[model samples]
Target chain A: MVKSRRTKAGDIGIAAICLLLMIICLLPMLNVLARSLSSSQAIIRNEVLLWPKGWNLEAYKFVLTDSKYTWSLAWTAILTVICTFVSMVMTTLCAYPLIYRDLKGRRLFNTLILFTMYFNAGTIPHYLLYKDLGLLNHPLVLIIPNSLSVFYMIIMRTFFYSIPDSLRESAEIDGAGPIRILFSIYLPLSKPVLATLSLFYAVGRWNGFSDALMYMNNRTYHPIQLLLYNILNAITSIEIQTQEGFASAPGLSDTIQAATVMFATVPILLVYPWLQKYFISGATLGALKD
Target chain B: MKRSSAINRKRIANYLRKYWTLYLMLSIPLAYFVVFRYIPMTYVQIAFKKYSIVKSPWEMPWADNNGFEYFIKAFRNLDFLYALRNTLLLNFLDLVLGFPAPIILALLLNELPFPRFKRLTQSVAYLPHFLSWIIIAGLAKQLFAPTNGMINIALNRLGFESVPFLNDPVHWVFTYVFLGIWRNVGWNTIIYLAALTNINPELYEASAIDGANRWQNIRYITLPGLRPTIITLLILALGQILSSEFDRPFALTNPLVNSVSQVISIFVYRYGIRGLQFSLTTAVGLFQSLICVIFLMAANALAKRFGERGIW
Candidate 1:
């Protein structure tokens, strides 16, 4: 009975520690939400903590209605969808050929794929190549340049390789071509991997900023991340000006910045839980491969 | 003999014809690599040249006969050394402090009896990984504000002095490392937790039969089981020694703390993206990539020697 009580106490201690760590992990995000909703004056007075003070939607109103933020959101969504689809299709197609058991020069092809993972041609040549290809500022530049991630392709290839050879042999005997076998047999069996890859590609494209920043010079083509970057830059500049006493208002800058951050992050955070299972599974697939 | 040779060539041609569609499918990725990855490597020569936008990357005049001139210039730049130091320091601290955090968290979570609470905590902890650096940085600014920040308020309530969390260079590394742990620990923990589940339950049962306490079970069974994973992760982290967290510092850094906050990637951006010094930026990028390649290869070799699975 004494031992049981001690064990119970240990469990409680462990639970408490876990709870506290979770809170610490969540504190920054909660703080952002609190700061966004709190009145600028209340925030400046340091009244906000776990909850908002003088609860206001003014910040959200400004961010949502703001043309720049909304337009960038639309662009990011469009780019993410298009890029994810392109990546999935290309990766699937690329893996299909490599997965064929009887394909000649398979080893050489696999090595060629893996080579890109180890060595890259640097940035300038890529830029020049894009310029020469007339892909500059084109939406396709974002999708095409990064359509095939070799690491992901390899994972999908491994998944395909796990399918029994008899299945393909039977399909071939039934007069189904390679394309039909891929669509009818391999794809259905590969749903988990495809789902995982799709989520990975989607999240990557959604968060992608550097590509837009580099290739898309036109502001119209800017994704949400680049927009957020510019917004942060503007906020920093405002802070610098305020320090120099050029701007009289202080609270407004902080509120706007907080709001912009919330706007940039909240949508992604909302969709994250939906993709969490896939991402966790996908991350482990590499470790699981013997 | 000529007839046999011609027949052999015909057989090879027939084989190629049979797999024509497969080759066509393979061509797309190959084309992409050529255009996107391989061709870009040709431009690395610009590092030795006074590359002009008007002139071609190849046609540009060499700075000197020696290929090391730009490298020397990069080393001479005060910011380069500072950036390199800061990058290495941050990566080292992260590997030291941030590496074990997720594994511990995963183990603790694995011990939880309440499934609902476990799921909730896992979801909440992992939420930060999805947030863009812009948002994380913005949140950091609010929490770490010297006077009116929530952290300062809490400190004041506890009768401690309000710390200049963001501004002070001394605290920069700690803040960066801590923030990294907060944002990434959950995501990292998921991998270990997955590995832990693969641990057979019979071992635990056998340990229990032997009267092994929880601590002993964890030490003898769990730690030993997790060694390979821990080593693999360590090697992966070492491979990324030069690539510091870009978004975190980019967002968190201000003029006051730029010295400690600046990293090689940020440095490249400052010169390459913002300044449009394409040639120099490419040079810096090449330099970083080369270091990363060397470190990655070295770590892989070391991992192989240590009998751990390395990412080859």
Candidate 2:
């Protein structure tokens, strides 16, 4: 009975700490949601907290109605789809060959691929290479240059290695080629890793801005992230100029800024919860450290 | 023996012919790595060259080698030094404060008796990990703005000064590290929690039967079990002391705080993209990679010495 009471007290203490941390994570974001929904005057007066002071959907309407925001959103969606498709194809092709121990020059390929994780020629040379390839100012600049992540390839390779070789050997004996076996056998069973890597590539391409900032000079081709980056910079610079803060910038209000940020973030965040189980499995498996 | 070796070679050739499709599949990604990843590595020599736009960096010019001029310029620049200092300081703070955070969180969470409540807390905590740095930086500015941020409002309500959490240089580091911890602690804990499950529950039962208190049980069983994982992760963190997250620093920084917020990766980006000082930035990039390689080797050696898994 004494032990049970002590355990109960301990559980309560643990629960309280966890609850506090969760609140710390939730309150700031919830406050952003509240502020985005609140009136401009309420926001300027700092009246909003966890709840909106004067309920309104003006911010959402402005963000949704803005042609630039809508265009950038569409551009990001298109870029993400193409980039994810290309990345998955390249990653699987690279990963599958490495799974075979008898493959010619396997060691050389492994060393070359792994060398990139340790060293790169940095931004300038990367820019030069993309320019040489005529990738600048083109949508291919975003999609092609970063189509294959070596780390994701390594993870997929590991997943493929986990599959039994007997399956491949039996299929090979039945006169099935490597491509046929990959499409019909391996890929169907490797859905978890495929889904995880596809999501990783999609989310990565969606959130990416550095490459766009460097390679893309055309604002029309700018992803939503780069657009949001410019907008945020404009907002902050304006705030710096005016000590009287939290006011609207031209047609961009505090609520609109909040709304756009939420808009830029919510699509991927929505996908996260549904796919979270794979996230943990992917991370832990990929980070197994040999 | 020679005849058997010849047979082995013939068998290997036959195997390759049979699996030719695999090699065909490998060709596209190999071409990508060669053109995109490997080609730039050859261009690192531009750091040592005085090549301009008229003469492409790939051209192996015979004249004006300009040996180490860009390196000398980069080292002599004040902005480079400031960026270096900021990178070191922020990374050290992250190592000290942020490294052990997930471990502590995992420990606290492992103590929870109710599985449902534990899971709810985990889901909420992990939400921040998925939010991009752009969104986080925006949320951060909103939370810490001097005029009417919620933090400042709370300070005012209590009759305290409204600290410029993001604006002030002194407070910015604290805010930055705090947000880093908040963004990552939950996701980081997943590894530690996985490590925790590997601990033998039977040992805990035996210790309890021997009248060990909760603290003693944790100290004896939990800490030791977690030590290898802690060491391995510590080595990995140490390896990344130089290449801090580029997006966070880039998005969060403004001119007011750029002095303290500039980091090496951002330095590379600013110079390479905006300034177009290609040679100097590549020199700095080389320097950063060199130091990181050294640090990685040293950390791996240290981990191996301590009987933990080294990254290699």
Candidate 3:
């Protein structure tokens, strides 16, 4: 009875600690949400705390109705989908040929790929190359240049190496080609890895702003993150110039920024829970071998 | 003999034919690397000449080789050095403070008994990792505002003087480091937690049976278990010492705090993009990459000597 009581007490203590930690992690985001929804007067009064003083959705309405935001969202979505597909295909195909243990010069190919992680042609030369190739302002510029990530390729190759040799041997005996075996046998077993890597590539493409800033001279081609960045910069400059304080337009102050952040964050956050299980597994599978 | 040689040739051809589709699939990626990665490497020579967009890189308009002209110029520029110093100093602070927070958090999380709550806390902690630097920085500015900011209001409520958080140069590094920890600590903790999961449970059971306390168990067992991961990640971070630009400082920088904010990448951007000194920009970039490569190699060698599995 005493031991049971002790265990119960321990459980309660752990539960309390966990709850506190979760709040700490989540408070900033919740604060942002609260500020976004509060009335301008309430924001000025600084009365808004855990909940908005007087709720309003004007910020959301403004951000959503804005053509820049909408166009950038469309741009981000297209880029994410196309980049994810290309990255996955490149990784899988490059990994497949290198996975064959008996392949001559496999070590050389592996080393060459790994070398890219440590050294690169630097940024300007890359820009010049894109300029020379007439890839500047082309949407494919974003997709093609960064299509093959050596880290992802290495992970895929490691996964392919783990597949039992007998599966390939049996398939070969049945007159199956390498491509057929890859499609029929290897790919099905690689679902977890595929999902994890796809999420990685998608998130990267969605969040990518530097490429848009550098390559895309036109404002229309900017991704959603870039748009948000510009808005944030504008807000900062406004605050710097006025010194009038956030209370002047309290309704617009907290909530709009918060809403914009949430809008940028929500899509990736929504996908994470669905792919959470695979993320850890994929990370382990990739890291454990080497 | 001729027949045997022909058969040998036929076998080689058959092998090539069998794997042709696989090679075909790999062609696009190979071409991408050649055109985007390898070919651009040739343009690094433009750093030695006065390069113009009108004339190709091979056509040098200037007679001077300019052996170290750009490097000397970049070194002499006080703004460049100030930026370099600020970058190194901030990175050092991040290494000192930011590196350990995740390990400690992971350790604390590991000790907690409730699984559901633990998982929930972890998810919440990692949410900020997905936020773009712009959003995070904006949030920071709002939260740390001198008058209307939540932090200052709380401090005033507690009867303390409100601090100038963002504008003050003295406070800039602190804000940068604090935000860095807030944004990245959870994501990094996840890696450590993953490492912890791989540790055998029996070792903990054995330590418990020996009457070891929780702290001792962590010090003796958990810390040792995390050594390889810590080392590997440290080496990776060291390799990125010259490359951490565009995210934290970029978002935090303003004219007020520009002294402490400009990093090597920002420097490159200023010279390359805004100034349009393409050759000088490329030279600076090449110098940064070379430094990173040397650091990575040295770290890898050190890891090998210490008997840890290095990136190599």
TM-score of chain B of each: 0.92, 0.93, 0.95
**lDDT accuracy of residue A136 in candidate 2:** 86
Best-to-worst ranking by TM-score:
2, 3, 1
TM-score per candidate, chains pooled: 0.92, 0.94, 0.92
Segments of candidate 3 deviating more than 4 angstroms: A1-18, A236-254, B1-4, B61-66
Q: Which candidate is the best by TM-score?
A: 2
Q: lDDT of each prediction vs. the true structure? A: 0.79, 0.84, 0.78
Could you tell which candidate, 1 or 2, scores higher by DockQ? 2
lDDT of 3 at A275: 83
Candidate 1 deviant stretches above 4 angstroms: A1-4, A131-134, A236-251, B1-14, B276-279
In model 2 chain B, where is the ten-residue run with the lowest total lDDT? B57-66
Ranking by lDDT: 2, 1, 3
Compute the lDDT for candidate 1: 0.79
Per candidate, the number of residue pairs that clash is: 1, 0, 3
Q: When only chain A is evaluated, what TM-score does every model earn?
A: 0.89, 0.92, 0.88
- Note the residue pairs that clash in candidate 1: A121-B41
Please give the C-alpha DockQ score of model 3. 0.51
DockQ-derived CAPRI band for the predicted complex in model 1: medium
Cα lDDT, model 3, residue A29: 68
